[model samples]
Target: MTVPTLTLNDGKTIPQLGFGVFKVDPEETERIVTDALEVGYRHIDTAAVYGNEEGVGRAIAKSGIARDELFVTTKLWNDRHGADESKRALGESLEKLGLDHVDLYLIHWPTPENNNSVETWEAFPSYRDQGLTTSIGVSNFDHRYLPQILDTGIIPAVDQIECHPQFQQIETRPLLTEHDIKVEAWGPLGQGKVDYADTVIGEIASAHGKSWAQTIIRWHLQRGHVVFPKSNNRDRMAQNFDVFDFELTTAEVAAIDGLENGGRVSGDPAEVN
Candidate 1:
């Protein structure tokens, strides 16, 4: 169960497969996160807006896992995209997570309507300089906004985006690749919006003797994207992590790629503000 790591632009490495706590209940976050840790997940992704950083921190402390052995990620919320606001935001998130520094910090969304993402992105380097975060990136950002961020001479290490078979983000992938920025796929299973059970993916799963969810996760891994599929049930969490044994053939990956329909199940990056 050794998870592979991707090298970031800043020379840091991140676990390719991790656990994400997006909508998990705050009260149960500790228990859930604890279960994930026990199931062999070393990378944990949380956000200030998730309101569960305290619980995640509790689980980390209780596990007694050496801080250096784990990778933690949190995001600055949209409202904090003002001068020096992200600085305060990351400090608070660190406080909640009971950590002096996080492995990675991100701008949660572009929020273009606010017209301040560039200003927000400009300050990210300073956070890294201050040792508040080791790597800085953005989420839910598309080409429209990324160019401006790039113009600031700070290329993001990764762009956490909603990516699945149905919405492969064809328009944005090239841009990210061109910049050598890793694509961290959130909602890798389409957030339950696309039924993998009845599609070619299910057939592929049957052939590989794996679950539909596992098959999709394999697809993501095979495609070289960093992914954190969320699951509260320990068994399912383990199942998701059990993808390393099998490999999807090139044709099989092409079959999954065919499932792309150019649709997004979540917020439009340009409109999420």
Candidate 2:
């Protein structure tokens, strides 16, 4: 099936639905990534800190898919939160991914302790200018740093935040919308922390004749945000990729939205930074 795509602020496009490798075993990355690729997923999300870029690279190389046809994304870790370290981190990530350039790169965190996100994000342009990364963005950045990063007049192409129905970015999404930055949901399924099976999400999934995971993924897609649902299971990976065939209704989307209770499964931007 053909996955839908979203146009970034920079005029570059990304698949709205992609596969992720958050906690996958490094030894199993190649096998799992290859599974995802064979399931017709062209977009793969990884990070240097994930310790699986090399395995992702190996799967791509082994797949024989042309470079331009795939969308690969990696990030700069929090410790690499500086101008110089940002540049070096991307270079190392590229080397590990076995690619001369990545489709997208992001600042992993705002690094609130040092408040150095602005300084680190400032170096993204050099990578774009150097042709090391086609597009650049940030992750886990809340309203606090959005303006600071944009004050430099360098708006990111996207901002990948931890957005799930339970913890929707009621505040951050609008700021990104105003700035033309795409919203990419990192844990679209709540890293399995979300109990969709016995909740309203489960009812929606039943109506659509789909799994809870597929229904939630459809929610993100219909909302016009980008999402990456990670799964090492081949069937589950295909299930996540098969969301394009149906669309959620307005009330269904709103019901899912109502499930929000200010819950967040991962590090909060306010506390983590």
Candidate 3:
């Protein structure tokens, strides 16, 4: 199946559905990513901190897919917030990925305690200008950080956040919309903390003849957020990619949206530093 793309603020396009290797074992990354590639996933999201970029690179090399057909993304880890450290970090990540440039590179987290998020963001453009990464963005950033980052005369193309049916990020969505920054939902399936089988999601999934995971993925797509759900299992990887065949109705989307109850299942951006 062909995946839809989203145009970033910089005019570059990203595949809306991709594969993520957040906690995948380094030893298993190559085989798992190869399976995902075989299942028709061209966009792969990994980070230096994941300790699996080399495996991802190996899979890409072995797959024999052309470079242009893939969208690869990696991130700058929290400890590398200094200007020089950030550049060096990307260099190391590129070396590991076996690519000269990544399609997108992100600040993994705000690391608010360091008081250097803006400084880290400031160095991002140079990475793009020097062709180290085509686009730059921030992840797990609170809306409060945007104004400061905006003052640097650059707007992020997207913000990768921990979003699912339970924690909708209402407080940050308006600011992101005002700035034309797209949302990339990291835990689109709620990171297993959400029990889809017995909730409204289950009912919605039943009505559509789709699994709860698939239904939520459909909800994310219809909401226009870029989503990449991860799985070590090949069948589940194909299932996640199969969302393009059906579209969710407005009411169905609303019912899923109504599941929000401030249930954030990951690190708090404010405290991650």
The backbone clash count of each candidate, in order, is 0, 1, 0
Best by lDDT: 1
Error of 1 at 123 (Å): 0.5
**Candidate 3 lDDT over residue span 83-152, tens digit each:** 8999999999999999999999999998889999898899899999999999999998867777788788
- CA lDDT, every prediction? 0.93, 0.90, 0.92
Model 2: weakest 10-residue lDDT segment is 264-273
Cα-lDDT of candidate 1: 0.93
TM-score for each candidate, following the candidate numbering: 0.99, 0.98, 0.98
User: Which residue pairs of candidate 1 clash?
Assistant: none
* Residue runs of model 2 more than 4 Å from their true location after superposition: none
Please estimate how well model 2 matches the true structure, expressed as its whole-model Cα lDDT.
Answer: 0.90
Could you tell me which 10 consecutive residues in candidate 3 have the lowest summed lDDT? 141-150
Question: How would you encode candidate 1's per-residue C-alpha lDDT over 184-218 as one tens digit per residue?
Answer: 99999888778888999999999999999999999
